[model samples]
Target: MLTNIFIIAITAEAMSGALAAGRRNMDLFGVALISFITALGGGTVRDMLLGNYPVTWTQHPLYIYLTIGAGLATILLARFIHRLNQIFLVLDSMGLIAFTIIGCNVALKLGYDTPVVIMSGMTTGIFGGILRDIMCNRTPQVLRHELYASVSLVVAVVYLTLMSLGVSHGVNTWGTFFFGLLLRLSAIRWKLSLPVFSYSPGRWGD
Candidate 1:
């Protein structure tokens, strides 16, 4: 369930971003490249780290086709998509939830320790957006302020702890996803930021 939602949300975000790029007069190749990267970059990294060769989309070619179809559809309907930011925000939120769940799940399946699983989850949830930001010439939020990656890490640890205590997979997955999603949405809506790290001049020199 979480994995499927990740795929769907990513496809939508990729399609929208591709359409936005195209509207700037980019060529088809450029649009496709952006869409493909946005859709699959993080999952690819996660699979690679897990030694899951021939990743999910590669095994299921339809994932590629589905993203392509979404891209084409977005291009056709871009004019109709008022308030594109709203669409992106909702999809992005869903993607965060889904990706974080699947990441921790995969790590757990691989027989990793809980700490490693939590880190894996954080990587899966944030890396693709970091890639997208670099490609689009923006600062990746994962490397910036707020509780973004920290939230993902915390949820993963909590989810893994629950599972270790014999919680059902479904409950553990959905519960963590919702908790992280709601927390992130609230952070965004309220402009809630993580406390900034401050250092004394002497400490900095040391």
Candidate 2:
């Protein structure tokens, strides 16, 4: 079940990345590059941070093939993609939540404590999007959009708490996945967001 979600999440992430590249009028290579990063960059970054060596995708090259195929498919389907914007958001939310779960599981396996586990999940959930935005020369949506990182944090916290309370691994994973997905979708539907704080100095107060 988790494996299925992982596959779906990466495919969705890759397609979304291709769409981002398409919006920029990028070429095929650029689309593929962004798609790859958006699908796997988060896990790569997390592994690097923990010095886990040889990253997940490096060992599992089929994941690369899958993401690249998804990216190319997005190009072929670009004409109809706009019609599915809401569907796109739903899939993206799934990917976000799944990525968070994967990150938390990795940190737990590495014997990290709660703080690091939470941070690991957030990093894995958002950093790929962050890297995608940087490469595309735009502000990362996770940094500014509704409840993005907050969703990851919430998922990780609740997941860890449940684990501490002796919830079965399968049950905890499934329960938290739905809970996080609901929170994210609600945030999108209601336009929930963290309050923006903009600060500027008026020429050092003149």
| Highest TM-score scorer | 2
**Mind giving the per-residue lDDT tens digits that candidate 1 earns over 3-113?**
678777878767855765575566776677767776777778888988877786798887787776677677777777676777677677778777877887788778888
lDDT of 2: 0.92
- List the RMSD of every prediction in angstroms: 3.4, 1.4
Best by lDDT: 2
Per-candidate Cα lDDT values, in order, are 0.75, 0.92
Writing each residue's lDDT as its tens digit, candidate 2 over 31-119 gives 99999999899999999997778799999989999999999999999899889889878988988898999899899899998899998
- The stretch of ten residues in a row with the least summed lDDT in candidate 2 is 197-206
Tell me the lDDT of model 1 at 5: 86
